[model samples]
Target chain A: MALFATCLTDTFYPDTARAVVRLLERLGCTVDFPLGQTCCGQMHFNTGYREQAKPLAQRYAGVFAGYHAVVVPSGSCAGMVREFHPGLVGASPATTMTYELTEFLVDVLGVTDVGAYFPHRVTYHPTCHSLRMLGVGDRPLTLLRAVRGLDLVELPFAETCCGFGGTFAVKNAETSTAMLADKMRCVLDTGAEVVTAGDNSCLMHIGGGLSRVRAGVRPVHLAEILASTEEEPWAAIR
Target chain B: MGSNPVTWLGTPPFPKAAHAALGDSQLRANLRKATGTIRAKRAEAVAELSDWERLRRAGEAIKDDVLSRLDTYLERLERAVTERGGVVHWARDAAEANDTVLRLTREAGADEVVKVKSMATQEIGLNEALAAGGVHAIETDLAELIVQLGHDRPSHILVPAIHRNRAEIRDIFRRQMPSAPPWLSDKPVALTEAARRHLRRKFLSAKVAISGANFAVADTGSIVVVESEGNGRMCLTLPRTLITVMGLEKIVPTWRDLEVFLQLLPRSSTAERMNPYTSVWTGVTPGDGPQRFHLVLLDNGRTNALADPVGRQALRCIRCSACLNVCPVYERTGGQAYGSVYPGPIGAILAPQLVGDMHDAQAASLPYASSLCGACYEVCPVRINIPEVLVHLRAQATAAKGSRGPEALGMAAAGWVFADPKRYEAAQRAGSLARFLARDGWITRLPFPGSRWTASRDVPAPPAESFRMWWRRTRG
Candidate 1:
């Protein structure tokens, strides 16, 4: 299986890439990144710059030319590749194929867990793209269930958007803050110390809300949780 | 909002109402609050079902079948309605529909008509049309009355007065209702009674009522109005002349189709297992309900919309508020931004489809309204890929002869760059280099429509290195 460490994880959040790679390798897959790969053109496509999105599509197609399947850590990026790519290209043949991280971990790889352990009262925040766009329902939950000693408490309104819709946060800041407050209330309701999700974008929004409210809960990515075990930082404690 | 098109939100392809709506902050806030609540609730309700995708597919199939054979079902419905002693009127446009209803009211010798909360009526501006014909159309639904009396256009699809908080509602009731109790508080009960009192006499005395159908069942010649309150029942019954105006796309071929929509609509929109008061009326009877039943089938721009294969699928909309509830764009700016009777995700697609892509900022801006989030698609009772349709429309708008300069130039250059990988790599390298030169991580300034990108949010600067470059350095 090949992993597409999305531009975000590759650049700023490198630890997330390491965790994704580590978790996949433990699941017994030969993870590879075709060096020729670039961005998914999601930003351009979403911003109504369809023309700008096309090159990224062709570049992605060109880079992932011979790969069997491409998995990305983020549902948004993966959705851009899977749903938007063919759409942007529109009958122009492109060989690149992709799946969201949790989806590939559950669907193609058929492994719910990579034999990791994290004993904590944590809740899952379903990213907007993960829940609605990619429709990656329960694939992450299926993996989380396998973790040894993980409580996996459910977050209230887990499926509601945390209002960090790419440029939406700045575009409609007041309404965005209002929605984030509602999401925060739901998160705080679960009494879970940590909020886990498949995408970092959503995590950052929720984490920012937590920071603003000075809430005790922290946001963690699903990749990091899956990549942890008894020998790692998230191992069972005293 | 200005008289000229200079301050228009988009190119001169938008309808008038959308352009006007941009300036109304109170309406925007009301819409934002109402749509936000519904959108949140929809997610909660949808998540409970394990086979949501299957349900969406089923809904899509039912609506598609109905829309494809719409002519047949409509004919069957008209025949069934006539057989059951209900007069059927076919309207070619909003003018014809309103004229038909007003003429019928005059024929019935009724001066006033009680109204159900119907989006079609709003779309056609039926109340104002009736007023022009010297007929007073009184809205009986709680939220609608607030909007009607306040002289406000509805923001959200489901809760028309969604923009109003309880206190604002109380103020509207206190100021507008002649029979209002002087101590009407912001409490829900107080507000309800105030509206009830204001509308009670209208419902009892009004000899005619105009409504829009949630679904027009062709098999049974039935018109269904799904709502949370019983006020619809008052509008459906009581009046001697009950006229149900419907969009041509509101038909379902059979009871099985109704079954699929029933499951999808309520869950997707109001977050209920089923609508509380789903009044199903099929023509008239000896002494039951209305003595005079009239069904007006409205085809205002629907056939034109249907002619386009890609866009015609939007006709399958069940008027379920589900799409409105789950939309992020709707959650923010609220439903008023689309500047049509229809707002939110459906409005973005449907407004352009129902009304011709007009010349103004509102109509032109409607296609680009969404972030292409696809939440509306997920929540739609009928599985309309709203995002796909939006993108398609945007492309259409962009490709039109009137394409704007900045967008056209950018898209043209993009077409060349995107058509090749090596060219894309060069562009990315150039972009990254430009970002380095700019120093500031986010681009605060932009040129023209690119200015819209920087209008609110930071244009995330190109990173120091493209992922491909980093991959090459590490892998090589």
Candidate 2:
């Protein structure tokens, strides 16, 4: 299996990518990181540059063509590949092989318990793409519940977008911030030490707001929490 | 008078308009309260049916079949209505539709007409057109009446005064309605009673009435209007001459097909099993209802919209406003920011297409107003893939802007870099140089385009090494 660490995770949140590698290896699966992969063309495709996105989509298909399974840690990127690649580059073998981290863990591996440990009060926010696009329902929570020492509190209005809609945050910043403010309030209301989601893009927006306000709450990726164990504990990178 | 009233002239682009709307705390509060309440109720109402998904599929299929052969269904409808003692008028655009209605009102020799809250008439700016022709159009629906009385644009599809709370509404009534009681309170019943008493005289005295149909059954030549208030029934029955302006797309082939929409519309819109009033009329009825009836089938850029294979699905909208209620963007910015009568997720896709001018900056910006969260698509009764259509429209808007624009140049540059891993890694390493400006691992501010992001949210400084660099160093 190959790991498709999305462009956002590779640049600003490299540790989240590392966590995925660690978790997959620990689950007794050999994972390959394809060096030729850069992006899934989601940003370009979504922002009205379909012609520009074509090359990236082609690159994605070529780089991961023969892999038995391609595990993507981000739901939006996975959706871009599985749902949209057919329209852009036609149906490639890699498109069907690609799976979101939670989908791969639960459906492919058939394991809810990954033998992980995290001793913090954490709330789970279901990102819009993961919830609605990929339909990764309760799979992350199902895994979190089996973590030996973790408390998974439900986020109020967890289905709402965190408003980090790629260029949308830049183009329509005020409206984006208004949405982020509500998401931040919901995260704060949980009173949990950490807020976690499958997609780091949304986490970055939510965490950016929380960090700006000095809210003292950490926005951690689901991979980092699942990768943590008694022998190797996950520490805050920031 | 030559200028088209249908155009949202001088309205700023969506982002600029939304920026102003975001500052209005009162409007924000009203929108949040109303949409949130409806969102919950709609969810419960939809959940009651075990076969809701099946019904939604049927609705989509039925609408698709109608749109596939719209000309046939429309001709069949025209013939049926003509046989039943009604006049059918084909309007290629808003100007023609307005002219037809104005001529009809003039023929009736009535200066004033009562309306049943039709989006078609709103799209055509029919009232303004009539007023220009020395005729008056009185809105009879409570919300439409409030909007008309307040001299305000209709902000929502179902509830035009959704931006105004009860206190604001009371003020509008007190200041605008001459018939409103001096001691009227802000209570819900009081507001409705006031609007009812004010419109009753107009309903009794008006010789001509106008409406937009919810569904027009082709075989039966019947027009359906479903409403919570009974004003639609009064307008349909009381007037001597009735004129209905309908969009070309609001047609179903058979009466049986109407059952699927009847089940979907009310629950998805008002969160009720059935609306309080559903008035379905077939042409004219002598000595029973209106003596003369005119049906204006409006094209008004619908054919242009229907020409696009992907965007044509927007024509299937039942106007339930379920998408509007669940939309987070609409919940915050309110409807006026969209600069069209159709606002929220539906407007984001529909307005740009109906206008058919992506070069128009305001219409172009509509597609970008959404976050592409897919919330609207999930809630739509007719299953319009709003996010898909939004992105598709954005591509058209981008093409219309040409390649010389800043956004286009940036996108082209990024596309070049992303085409190869070597160029992408080089760009990432260069991006990490911004860390020199970082304080405590975050870039609090930046310039131009980046400033837009850092205006409200902090940006994380790029890591020292890209993931590929780390992977090679550790595993090599």
The candidate maximizing DockQ is: 2
In candidate 2, what are the lDDT values of residues A146-212, reduced to their tens digit? 9989988889998988888889999899999999999999999989999999999998899888888
State candidate 1's TM-score.
0.80
Per residue, candidate 1 scores C-alpha lDDT tens digits across B391-463 of 6676666555344666466556765665555776687767665464333344555565545334333343566
Off by over 4 Å in 2: A236-238, B1-7
The local distance difference test score of each candidate is: 0.74, 0.92
Highest lDDT, which number?
2
Could you say which candidate leads in TM-score?
2
DockQ of each: 0.19, 0.85
lDDT of 2 by residue, B1-476 (tens): 21334447888999999988999999999999999999999999999999999999999999999999999999999999999999999999889999999999999999999999899999989999999999999999889888998898877899988999999999999999999887999999999888888989999999999999999999989999999888989999999999999999999999999899999999999999988899999988878999999999999889999999999999999999999999999999999899998999998998888889898889999999988999999999999999999999999999999999999999999889888889999999999899888888788899999999888888888889978889989874
